[model samples]
Target: MKKETGLRWLFFFAGLMVLGLGAALTIKGQRFGVGSWDVLHIGLFERLGLSIGLWSIIMGLIVITIASIGLREFPKIGTFINMTFVGIFIDFFNWLISDSNTFSVQLIAFIIGVLLLAMGSGIYISAELGAGPRDSLMLLIVKKTHFSIAAARTIMEVVVAVAGYLLGGPLGIGTIVIAFALGPIIQVTLKYSGKLLEKSVKVESVAHGHG
Candidate 1:
């Protein structure tokens, strides 16, 4: 059991790291993330004279509330961690940008920021601690609308991206790229990770005489 738990954690952290690296790469690519929601949020906060981190927390709470209403079975720990940690990391990256002396320096920071964000998300997700609020919401929509998960996610992201753009959020190349690519990326990542997890579980079960 201990070994299994440790392995789970290992996978979780690995996912997180990968997610962060992905984010960094997306930023470096000078393209929008697959979702690009964060870009909009950050831009909106900057315009409103509010701290982006604070805005993230606020937005996370709102999403969490929606998730609670929509998917009552979703775990709270994962939701909370996703919300809080995301805010912290965004803020940390924002600070890095502020302190940097040149656009080039800040660009590098932005890339790193994206990577960390992706990594953290990947790790937390692998932990299976709980689905992120947004993911929960996506699942809820899938259940309610009978739409495929991919379709539902794409629709939701599109709606959010449009709204964010209207609200003066960053809706640039990155946003466009993210909107088109995030679904596929997530599908691939989750599928690969799930297979690995299943194999690991089977091995454990066999050793325990349950398989």
Candidate 2:
């Protein structure tokens, strides 16, 4: 049991790191516009003179604070770990892949990044540790307004996308694609990843019993 719990934590952190890598890829893809929250981060980076990674961490902290104060929800350790390391990894990846050029390469990077983000989200969520800061806020909104999760998420994304666009963030086809496709992608990813995790746990349990 303890071994399984530790493995889950490892998977959770790995998912977060992959998410950060995906975010960085999307941001540095040059031609591809980023996801909604990333639009906000880019806008803030443009106006505030901080790195996008820094903005992500700051915004994540702000959202977590709101969840605690306004929604009376306490964040899990996984949340804080996600908030901290994701930004750092984003920065690292952006720096590492700073020189990617060409439209085809950029487009490929964007598509892969989006898929990676969905996969990472699914893997982390399956751990049942807790949500990322933005997701936590979305849940709070859903709770308070009695809105469906989809509706609440859409509202938040639209607001942020608009705000970010107004502030001169990149808004392009990729952004629109993400708005429409992300839910379905994450849903499919979670379903499969959940099954995979269940299989792994069962295998581990059987091995432990034999030992």
Candidate 3:
């Protein structure tokens, strides 16, 4: 049991690191990330003079509220971790890597960002601590509408992407790529990692019974 819990945490932290990396990449991609929410935030900030980071935090809280109401699930450790840590990391990366003045530098950052995002999201979901608030909302939509997870996720992404664009958030190549790719990336990562975790758990249980 202890070992299993420890492993889960390991994956969770790993996921966080990856997520941070992804944020950096999306920023570097010099394109709006593949979503409407980001586009909206960027648009709003650019046009209306809203603080992107602050608005993001507010949005996250609102999502959490919707998740609690719709899903009836309390905010778990993973939920809190994602809400708090992702913002901190986003700001940290924004400040630390703000000087992407050159094409080469921007390209490097974009690649690294995408890789990290894919890996982090994979790790976090595999931990199964509970889906992140945004994801929870996605799941709720899936259940209520009887839509496939992929379709639901894609619709949500598209809606956010469109809204973000209207709101004046960053919208570009990166956003499109992420919109199409994120679901597959997360699905593949979670599928394999989940198998590994299950095997580990079963092995531990057997060993414990023998002991």
Candidate 4:
């Protein structure tokens, strides 16, 4: 049991780090815009005098607070960790990978970054940790309005993207790609990773029982 729980945490953190690295790549790939929420974060960072990660943390807190108010919900420990640590990881990775000069390189980086983000999401979900703050809010919106998940998410994305654009965030091809491709990518990643995690859990349980 301990081993299984420990492995889950390990994978959870690994997924968060990879997700952060992907976000950093997309941010540094200035030719293409990032995801809708990230656009807002970038804009906030630009107007305010703080690191991108700091803006992300601040925004995440706001979202979590709003979610708690609307749903009368409390966030899980994983949610807090997701909100804080992912931002810090993004800052660390942004510093490391901010210097790719060529357009081709930047485009490639952006594509890879999207894939990483999807994979990270899959791994984290498979860990059975709580949803991230943004996802928690998304769920709350869906529940409150009786909207389909897709509709609720679309609404949120559009509002945030427009606000970010007004605030001078990049609004470009990468954002479009993220809008269209991420759902499918996450679905596929989750399908495969879920099986793997399930298998691992079963194997560990059997081993522990025998021991």
Q: How much is the lDDT of residue 196 in candidate 4? A: 82
Score each candidate by Cα lDDT.
0.61, 0.82, 0.72, 0.82
Q: Where does candidate 4 clash, by residue pair? A: none
Shift in Å, residue 44, candidate 2 = 1.1
Clashing pairs in 2: none
List candidate 4 segments past 4 Å from native. 146-151
Answer with 1 or 3, whichever has the higher TM-score: 3
- TM-score, cand. 4: 0.92
> Who is ahead in lDDT, 1 or 3?
3
Per-residue CA lDDT of candidate 2, range 27-113, in tens? 877477988888888999898888988888999999999987767868998888888788898889988986577898899889988
Comparing candidate 1 with candidate 2, which one achieves the higher lDDT? 2
Off by over 4 Å in 2: 146-148
lDDT of 3 by residue, 1-211 (tens): 8978987888777787668656755665564353445566557668767455555556778888997888776878778777667766766776676665676777677767766776677778888886666678788898889987667777888888877877656777777777667777777888887888788788988988899
TM-score, model 1 to reference: 0.73
State in Å the error of residue 162, model 1: 1.6
Q: Kindly list the per-residue Cα lDDT of model 4 for residues 1-211, writing each as its tens digit.
A: 7888887887789889988988888887768888777888888888886988888899999999998888887888898999998899989999987577789988888888888987887778678777677777877988999986556666777778789889988888888777666656766777787788778889999998998
Clashes of each: 20, 0, 19, 0
